[model samples]
Target: MPRIFTAIEIPADVAQTLTFLRGGLPGARWIDPENYHITLRFIGDVDVHVAHDVASMLDSVNRAPFDLRLDGVASFGGRKPRSVFANVAPSQALTDLQAEHERMMQRVGLEPEGRKYTPHVTLARLRDSSSRQVADYLSERGSFRSAPFRVERFVLYSSRASTGGGPYIVEEAYPLAAIPAKRAI
Candidate 1:
């Protein structure tokens, strides 16, 4: 059984920018640039039948393509930081898309996601790094930002069941609705 999830693939140029934030902090296992993505929903290992249900259900999602921007850098877990990430600037379109995924998963018999959704791209996983170390790192590089990137589609990705930061395979992709061109008066 493959561990599956839905996410937006980071463009190469954006990923390259994120790579600059690597190193500097000890005990940080930096994620490979190619693996960078903004996860929409995390669906843990499920049976082949359930996976099929998920794939088919995702096809029904109708949303327009939207632009996303990386605004800053932040860390999760507060006092005992677990991972560092590039914060995604808040967008209602992104939130609505994610909410739809959550609802769809629950309709497929998966339980509700307990944590509130906070969209971000994981940069590194901290192992034994202290609070001071993480704070100092954030203090230096927390102002990181990236130019807005157009999100044309979302994908269903599969990964080996292990510690997160992926070697993800895109099993399928669902394109969002394209914006219509204005007609001449």
Candidate 2:
């Protein structure tokens, strides 16, 4: 089984900017900058056949490339502080692309994602970090922002079953265009 998801890779410059926020927070297992990505859809654990179907289905997603910015920082577990992430500035293009992925996955017989989409890139996995610790971390870096970057493509990624903030492998790649190319232009 492969734990799969579809995501847009963060550019190297942006990842370098994100690296500055890595240390200081207690119990924070910071994710490597190389693994930084804005997940479009999480397919979760699936068997080989379903994974193959997911890859084939995703190739049909036809959405244009668009700009994205990372703005602000936040914690997921409100009080308990399970993880920390950089919030993705919401854009209609990102939302539509994500929804299209959702629709495609369902068409391939995968379960719909239950959580409402809140676009973000996980920066760290929080374990024993306290509420005060989390709050303090957020406060210091709350206004963090990155230069906007173009999302020219999205990828099918695989990761081991573990507390995420990954070691992700790009299983396949798919390009984006202003419109789906019709029979090779």
Candidate 3:
């Protein structure tokens, strides 16, 4: 069985920008820039057959490339601040793509994802940072935003099952349709 998930790769330039957010907070285990990604769906350990079905079904997704931006910074686990992340600006295309993946997983017999989809690229896993520490950090860098980046493809990544934030391997990639050029009137 392999642990896998679908996600949009962050461009190198954007990843470099994100790297600046490293350090400052104690107990923050910064994620490697190479592992930064906006996950579409997390499909936990599955048999070979289900993995093959997921890979095959993902190729059937039909959607045009869309732009996404990292708009702000935030943390999860309000009081305890379990993790920090770069917020992704809302995009219907992104939401639709994620929803499609959710539906596809169910079609493959996986349970519906229990949590509401909150799209973000995690920056670090907090071990003992308090709410004040997280709040102060956010206050200082809350206005961070990245230039819009085109998402031309999404990929299926496999990772060793362990605590999250990892050395993920791209098992396969699925490209989105190119946006058609406008015709001059």
Instruction: Show where candidate 2 strays beyond 4 Å.
Output: 180-185
Per-model TM-score versus the true fold: 0.95, 0.94, 0.95
Report clashes for each candidate as comma-separated counts: 0, 0, 0
List candidate 3 segments past 4 Å from native: 178-185
Task: Compose the digit string of candidate 1's lDDT tens values, residues 1-185.
Answer: 87899999999999999999998998899999999999999999999999999999999888899999999999998888899999999999999999999999999999999999999999999999888999999999999999999999999999998787888999999999954767999
Note the Cα lDDT for every prediction shown.
Answer: 0.94, 0.91, 0.95
| lDDT, model 3, position 71 | 96
Candidate 3's error at 102, in angstroms?
0.6
RMSD of 3: 3.8
Local error of candidate 3 at 13, Å? Answer: 0.1
**lDDT (C-alpha) at residue 131 in model 2:** 92
Please write out the lDDT profile of model 2 over residues 29-105, one tens digit for every residue. 99999999999899998999999999988777777889999999998987788889999998999999999999999
Decreasing lDDT order of the candidates: 3, 1, 2
